[model samples]
Target: MNATPTEMMTIAAARLLTNQDVCFVGIGAPSAACNLARLTHAPKITLIYESGTLSTRPSVLPLSIGDGELCDTALTTVAVPEMFRYWLQGGRITIGFLGGAQIDRFANLNTTVVGPYDAPKVRLPGGGGAPEIASNCGEIFITMAMGTRAFVDRLPFITSFGHGKGKGDRAALGLKTKGPTKVMTDLCVLEPDPQTAELTVVSLHPGVTREQVQAACGWPLRFAADVAETPPATEQELAVLRDLHARTRQAHGVAA
Candidate 1:
């Protein structure tokens, strides 16, 4: 009857995609949310991967971007270079779904080195194609677990670009694609400021307080004066999401 935090986040993210959009889906939360969209409202939405697979429909969560299921179930598989050159860089792909190690107020992400680029605190798996995804995709949506460490006022490094020079700067940079359109976190949904595009809490999930959301965020996070409450996920949404995760773990040999 109630929505798990993940399911609520997925529903919130799913609503952003549409049948007319071509989406570049990241692994984990982004994958789950994108698939939810395909199964629910945006059945015709085309899903793309960095590995050059398009329109992928896996019954289970993929272990990684390199998983064979993506290519196997894809509508077509292009060469890695071709995929970016034509589909992404060519300005055909409409949406990019991504997750990162660190996010800042400007919504820029850090996926390269953890603390410093050279002498890092914790070196993470470098951005696979996230930079290009952010740069070339028509638009993007980011999904990540919200914790004080992951959400900060300034990223440890700028691994993947969002609103690098702040909002409105993207237009001045002569970029074709817009910056991150939204971010879906466990306790809330955030959108960039209209001018600066700095991220601020726009809505709080049901039963979540502004203080709780702020405590979880790393930075001195700001909240809208009139933030709205997030609607809990419906029965149908929970069933689908739970089943999907169950099958994902069972098929991948990953314990849930």
Candidate 2:
């Protein structure tokens, strides 16, 4: 079966993980991708959730960080304070997987408010652990569907710092870890420019065009010198991902 764009994006993100990685996973798409990696190629990958589940290997995707399945499947559970103070802030997490309501050219994320701060058109859930996750992780990977409304030139509110304003911004701000190294979208894969720190298109998903990517982006998009085509999802990847989703739906008692 041909993979949907969302599935392709998740698989692409999952491929970036390694068995040696210790990932601090966010809920939603990032959760699915990290779990997919564990269920497939990166079986030994350590999965940590904000709710204090450490090294969890859930059979299905979790509805939230507090989902009981996470703790039940975890090798061990720690206090939320310890999870942050020791594991995350102590530089033990290799990757921070996240998604957001909006992202700017520099990859700064906004999940707070859509419009003005005080009186907003959409008051989104405030950033939970993302601020610390973005700052302390060895590197960060983002997953979100691309759209003009989401890939904005300016964020209404900066929820998590990426590259900040430009190249030296993170260093200037005294951030020691790499902020956002890659952003995997439904349309393509983006990485920070080596010099500029701006997000640039490095690979287009199957059948996705440069024009389509630009149309979806809110700013003037840039492409790498040798942009590559994202590999189509393998049968095994699709099968595993589908099975995971099916189980999640069944467990949650939702109609598939």
RMSD of each: 1.4, 0.7
For residues 62-126, write the lDDT of model 2, one tens digit per residue: 89897999999999999999999999999999999999999999999999999899999999998
Off by over 4 Å in 1: none
Give the distance in Å from residue 131's predicted Cα in candidate 1 to where it truly belongs: 0.5
After the best TM-score superposition of candidate 2, give how far the Cα of residue 195 lies from its true spot, in angstroms: 0.6
What would the per-residue lDDT of candidate 1 be over residues 111-149, giving only the tens digit for each residue? Answer: 888776789889899988998999998888999878988
Best by TM-score: 2
Q: Against the true structure, whose lDDT is highest?
A: 2
Candidate 2 weakest lDDT stretch, 10 residues:
57-66
Q: What's the residue-level lDDT of 7 in candidate 2?
A: 98
